[model samples]
Target chain A: MGATFMLGELVGGLRRNLSMAVSVVLVTMISMYLLGLGLLAQRQVDTMKDYWYDRVQVSIFLCVEGSQYAACAGKATTTVQREQLRAQLEQMKPPIKDIFYESQADAFKRFREQFKNSPLADQATERAFADSYRVSLTEAGKYEVVVSTFQGAPGVGRVQDQKQLLDRFFAFMSVVSWGAIALSALMVLCAILLMATTIRQTAFSRRRETGIMRLVGASNGTIQLPFVMETLVSSLLGASLAMGLLWATVRYGVGGYLSKALVDTAFIGVGDVLAVAPWVVGGVTGVAVVTSWFTLRRYLRV
Target chain B: MILFDSVTKTYPKATRPALAEVSLEVERGEFVFIVGTSGSGKSTMLRLAIREERATSGSVLVAGRELRALPDRKVPLLRREIGTVFQDFRLLPGKTVFQNVAFALQVIGKSRSIIRQTVPETLRVVGLDGKEKRYPHELSGGEQQRVAIARAIVNKPAILLADEPTGNLDPATSREIVRLLDRINRSGTTVVMATHDHEIVNEFRKRVIELDEGKLVRDQVGGDYGTTTSAIPVIRLDEAGEPGQAGDPGETGEVR
Candidate 1:
């Protein structure tokens, strides 16, 4: 009897306050959608980092004939200097996992292959290319060790970590992701405040009913249960809508557009959204229940 | 059935006490009237009886239990055995007459079968048998008060505390309400009514407890409107709207 009566009250309350309930749904949906997007963005950054870091290498470019670098001193690298650099790198085997030497001939061949369709390929010669040692690190992030050791050494014009440039891009992505999460936090706060206000207004309008219920010996739990359930149902609706929005974004927006446009980089998929679904729904429901309970306690007084 | 032992009630931030060490008791099945002017602590006494407010220096006992010692959770159980009515006829405006009465039972977790049986029966006793579908706004003032009475007594409470149940009705309607309350009281439920209606007091001739300036000035069995003066004189509309003579006990010691 209690369950059925409570269900009836829940439905009736929602119906009577349809516009308010819809507003709750919409606000909660927007907030939770942004929150989900933030979570997915964080995951996407992690995936991209894993994909790119495994392949990153530090390139030590050797001085070529007539090079302008101060280390080159406008002289070509000698066999002794080249041999000394290779021996030092070989001694640092713990940090340097593998080394491959690309001669000027090889460098020019690869450069032409890369820009074969461009007119610039016709102007480049083997003399224009620099002989380089590509050093793969045991740990991709330890590029600093190699750069600090070999920079401006004899026969070396420059030491560049491929991961450094990638790090700046990744840092920017991290900022964007955290900014989205922060904005989502603000939206969730707004959702809570709006729900509280809706509950307050409902309580005020039904003050007479609550007072009568109190007089008739209704327990606080009985009076407050309907209110909490009302908020829970509306918020759950919003949460489901948010989950749908998130799923669609992952399925079409990321998979269909971003994956096709940036084929080399991996993006978050529907499975990642499914992983974050429980936390988002659970969090929103918990907040809605607690907010309504506190609002009813302060306002309804039954 | 009800006991107030030296109940002294002083509201917060007030210059004077609302009820100053007043003591009173009404036995089982007694019909008692608590008569006083505005702010004479009549409502305060009722509120104390219902555990809405605690006595500052004394205790109140209802249905053989000390209300001061009652926990907040158990207060609802205590209130279940005692029904209350007010001057404003506090009915749920959105509910129909039947739903308003049934709401009292629903909140207490009564079964649907029990509610279906009890609501109509109680409504019949309140003389609202056919008007079950009418809302509070659609009903007359007297009818609305009847709905409130029906809601109060629907659970078959042991005591009924009415704080001026007939205050908003006409003289004829007020007498009818008082008669209905008298009928309910005769059915073995203790009735404690606080009112300023001299005509009902003089006609019904019940036990009267009059409070003057928060002091229990008179407690008389079969008391009249009293020979004492009041801040707001009771207008006797039943006597062709002419103000009745104050300070006259007319007749006493008879429960007619």
Candidate 2:
């Protein structure tokens, strides 16, 4: 019966202060939405990094006809020297996943396809390209080992890792994620302060009722339970709204644009969003509950 | 029952005491009137009884609990046994008359069955059985006070304290309120009324304890309003005679 009474008081109090209650819900929703966006962006960055890094290869370009290999005693890297390099690479089987030899003609053909729409496609020739061996690693971190080993090889002019070419993209994403996180933190702080003031005003408006409750032998917990429950209700409502918004963004917005833009790589799968949705819900709800509890404690003393 | 021994209350930053070395006793089921002009310690005495203010130097025992030594957590429990009605009525403006009365039982964690049975009965006792849906603002001053009385007595408390309960009502309404308090007293609830309304005091003729400059000046049994002549002899005897005579007068006058 006491619990029913308290629940009734909480509902009745919310009804009495409907505008402030709505404001609290809206504030929490916006704050959590921004936070969710930041988290989703970070997840996207991780997914992209995993997808692209797995396919990155280190390429070692062959020395030219008049280069150091031609002047050496081996002279133009005989079959013996080629076999020696191949054996050395084969020995690194655990770290070097696979090695593919791209002759000068194959390199020229790839360059023509890459710039097919540009004027540079007409000027590219098979003899102008370098014969290179592409090395795929089991992990991105092992790229440096392959690059260093091929640097002073008898027939190698230069070794380049494709992972380095993607540095600018990851740097840009890092800046965006940091900005989002900072803005989300500021907004969450505002939401907490707003929630505190709303609860305080609600309690003040009902001071007469609370005073009577105090005089009539109501426990401090009993008096405070209603206000705390009210805050929880507001927070839960806001979190639910934010979750819905996030789900919609992931399903409609990102699925339509981002997935198509990065067709070859996985861009935030629905399963990943579902896996992290509860955490977002729990995080927003926890923040709302804690902020409301502290605020009400100051004003209601319960 | 209530007992005070050498109770003294001094406010911070004030040289004079609000209540100075005062001692009094009220027996069970007794109706006593505490009377004094404004600032004469009438409200302070009532505050002490309600545990709102602690005495500086003395002990107060209410229903076998030492109030002066009681912790803050126990103060609310002590209040549960004592019902307080202020001049302001203090009804929650948002609640209906029914809810206002039901709140008393709700606060003590009473069962729904008890609340359903007791709230309407208490309201009926206060003569507001059919007006349960009205808010306090909609009720007249007399009706509001009746609602306040219903709330105070709904818990079946041991003591009832009313601080100028009729201060906002007309004279006729004030008499009606006094009658309602007397009716509650008849039902065996001890009532302590602090009022300066001489007409109500004279008509009721209950025990009146008057305070002057934080001192207990007169304690008369069957005391009438504006009749200080009978109190003078008792005071003179209390000052000049033996200490035993002081205690005798309280009993003798009370008996008469």
The number of the candidate with the highest lDDT is 1
**Compared with the true structure, what per-residue lDDT tens digits does model 1 show for residues B110-194?**
9999999999999999999999999999999999999999999999999999998888888799999999999999999999999
lDDT of 1 by residue, A183-274 (tens): 98999999999999999999887888888888889988888888899899999999999999999999999999989977778788999999
lDDT of 2 by residue, B1-256 (tens): 9898889899899779988888999899999888766666888888888777888899888878998788877777888888889888999887899989988888778999998899899888878899999999999999999999999999998999999897777778889999999989989999999876666787899999888768887888888644332344454333222334445544346323
- Evaluate all candidate structures by whole-model CA lDDT and list the values in order: 0.88, 0.80
Error of 1 at A298 (Å): 2.2
- RMSD of candidate 1 to true structure, Å: 4.1
Candidate with maximal TM-score: 1
What are the per-model numbers of colliding residue pairs?
1, 0
- TM-score against native, each model: 0.88, 0.85
The TM-score each candidate achieves on chain A is: 0.87, 0.82
For model 1 the local lDDT of residue A284 reads 92
* Residue pairs with clashing backbones, model 2: none
Give the Å shift of residue B242 in candidate 2.
43
User: DockQ of every model listed?
Assistant: 0.59, 0.43
Q: Give the poorly placed runs of model 2, Cα more than 4 Å off.
A: A1-3, A64-84, A103-130, A164-175, B11-15, B225-256
